[model samples]
Target: MTAIITTTSSATDTATLEPGAEAPANAGEAAAAASEAGAGAPALTGEHTDLLETLARHRFFLRFTTKDLTDEQAAARTTVSELTLGGLVKHVALTERRWMDFVVRGGEAFANGFSEREAEFRLVEGETLAGVLARYEEVARRTEEIVAGIPDLGAGHPLPEAPWFEPGASWSARRVLLHLIAETSQHAGHADIIRESLDGARTMG
Candidate 1:
């Protein structure tokens, strides 16, 4: 799929870098910003709150690693791997959007194409760190809205045929949410290493 770019430069945008602030100073602040960044969505409790909060915390860590970075630095590969900080942010956002579509629309969502999978990991001409960050924030907000408003987490669809997935299996919205959490967390670690190598900054101690 061609990467979509929908960016908003507002300071109040969720998980986005503020106008003057580079990024959240620490994980706590990042988490707090993520929580407070939401609009007046109805209050959630129990499993919904727990899952969203945990996911938000991890998302904060991932985005926090990109503090004070230039577009050149964000796109540069620090290690032998092809992964770059900007690329991870973009990739994760795209993946999350795809999965969310699946959560609502089922396996048909994948039929469009993943032709841009490789490009998703690199910054193309005109793609900037701030632009990608803004796009990610948009995707994140949409995710929060979708999950929060959905009536049931148990609603599910059959898995698309893939070697990585079990045959004849299905996944509920809850399972998809958990998978997104795991995927984002894993990529956040990758981004942390990339960030630390690029500079001396660490997302956590």
Candidate 2:
């Protein structure tokens, strides 16, 4: 994003940079300003608290997408894609459980491939929306507990041989939390769209 050049450059709104400092002109400067501002925010007690906070933020959006929807509505294919609100809920929960396995265990966790992974993105029979939601809640609570007990956020394991993940990369526990954020956020958007199509409902105003 383009930042304000100078305090005198604009009168509509003053961009908050350092005191008497000119606004950033580049991404690096913008990041620096943001870091400075964030530094002034209250310090988090630990990485677990920080990670859980982020996880909870994205989780809210995802869960909102499923709110007030009937089991049939959640399973309905409101969009051309196979995604449904219930399916997305199930998918994200399984994702968290799998990633948690990666965090606790390593490459040996679930040695499977794409050929066996497509089922995850579907709300199969017997998996009600409420049931899936409860499962996700359990996973969320368990994840917070796991994160709270970690020594540090630096723990990690090499990624498995999967076609989807980046090749030859190891993810730190911190990165795992970031991945969780991405997982929930991307699906949250999809879920929101599906939810709106299913009815006139929206996850956000």
RMSD of candidates 1 onward, in order: 5.7, 12.5
Residue 20, model 2: Cα distance from true site in angstroms: 43
Model 1: per-residue Cα lDDT over 1-205, one tens digit each? 1011111222223453433334445444544443454445456777776677667667777777786789999999999999999999999989999999999899997787687797999899999999998888788777777777777899899988878889999999899999998998899999988887877665644
Q: How close is candidate 1 to the true structure, as a TM-score?
A: 0.84
Q: Per-residue alpha-carbon lDDT of model 2 for 89-197, expressed as tens digits?
A: 8888888988888889887666653353586777778878889888886787677667766777997889997777789989888998998988887998898778777
How far out, in Å, is residue 84 in model 2? 0.3
Question: In candidate 1, how many Å is residue 191 off?
Answer: 0.8
lDDT of each: 0.75, 0.67
Worst 10 residues of 2 by lDDT: 1-10
Clashes of each: 1, 0
My TM-score estimates for the predictions, one after another, are: 0.84, 0.74
